[model samples]
Target: MCISNPNSISDQTDLVAMKARLWALLRKEEHEWLQKSRLKWFKEGDINMKFFHLTASSRAKRNQISKLKEIPVKRLSVGSRRLLERLFSEEEVWNMSCRLCLIEDSSFNNSFISLIPKIDEAVSPEDYRPLSLVGSLNKIVSRVMARRMASCLKEVVGENQFAFIVGKQIVDCVLIANEVIDDLSKKKKKL
Candidate 1:
């Protein structure tokens, strides 16, 4: 049946009637599919709670950073130093304070704090990653330059090597590669 009641946009009864009819058709199709095949929809069929839980866990584990290369935050503040005084030895405090000092130094231009997900069951120290943040001013300037240069870039960049070029897709490279392979196959037969 045609699924339109133009007046239903303003009329509640007509809208409800239309929705009931649509639901009836969908349920009818679902019953037919259930009868026709053994396969059931994932959410509506055989529930594998343990398998889904494990798959979700594996995906989360794979995305974690094994180690960090940068040592940007060196030290703890006096308050932090006091707090960590018992937890860390004297030597540890010195190392932490130096990094904290570096983080505070405005003279060290264009550095910002980076925070990312870390692996902990609950919110704790082990649950976050640190990265070097870039300056906002530099980001704005780079974006402006990219926008202005896009038109000029289209003229100079080759028909291939379309990675960063505007209005081109990597799919184009795949298509061109297929054509080259086909030509090579035909040429080999001729020779």
Candidate 2:
């Protein structure tokens, strides 16, 4: 059992105690008594912690988000009523083409809001941070849509962009910028 996760309660103890326990188990000569126990057929042996760590469990952590960094927010919650009224009344803007916007699952939005701290515990529906509870069907659909859209979006996007574009890294972007600056400086010096 301890072979699976060494950091478990039993494995975290001193080595001396474990060795003594193993030694006692080994010294025992009786066999009939083992038949009554749950692990009757199990063979005990030396544990290799390194071997166990090679594969990880697929389970998510118990209601915990690891290593959350501050995420930036844009636009205030609501604009002035006068501004909204003016926009609504504008004939030029209204006559132009219209596009629809969408809101993803509540869970998806709550996942972000929950990361931020609040002065009081969540009591009302608004206070509660939601977890994504979308069905498996929706998850599959989302994945397919993402794959299909990736190629289409790629053609229009610049090579330098990394934000929200799957697998791109800020570190790579910064490194490229540094290299360009260095090369430009070298050329300027030569001139």
Maximum-lDDT candidate = 1
The sequence of per-residue lDDT tens digits that candidate 2 reaches over residues 93-187 is: 22221211223454432222233324387566766555555543344445444544454555545566786567887788889989999999999
| lDDT, candidate 2, at 50 | 41
lDDT value for candidate 2? 0.51
RMSD of 1: 19.1
Runs in model 2 deviating more than 4 A are: 1-128, 163-168, 181-191
Give the Cα lDDT of each candidate. 0.63, 0.51
Q: Per-residue alpha-carbon lDDT of model 1 for 1-191, expressed as tens digits?
A: 44466555656676788899999999999999887665543653349777667867899899988898985433434554344334434564445445444444464447677667776453765677778776544444444445444545544455646777767888988999999999999999999
Q: Estimate each model's TM-score.
A: 0.29, 0.27
Q: What is the clash count for each candidate, in the order shown? A: 9, 0
Q: Give the candidate number with the greatest TM-score.
A: 1
Query: What are the runs in model 1 whose C-alpha is more than 4 Å off?
Result: 1-110, 115-130, 182-191
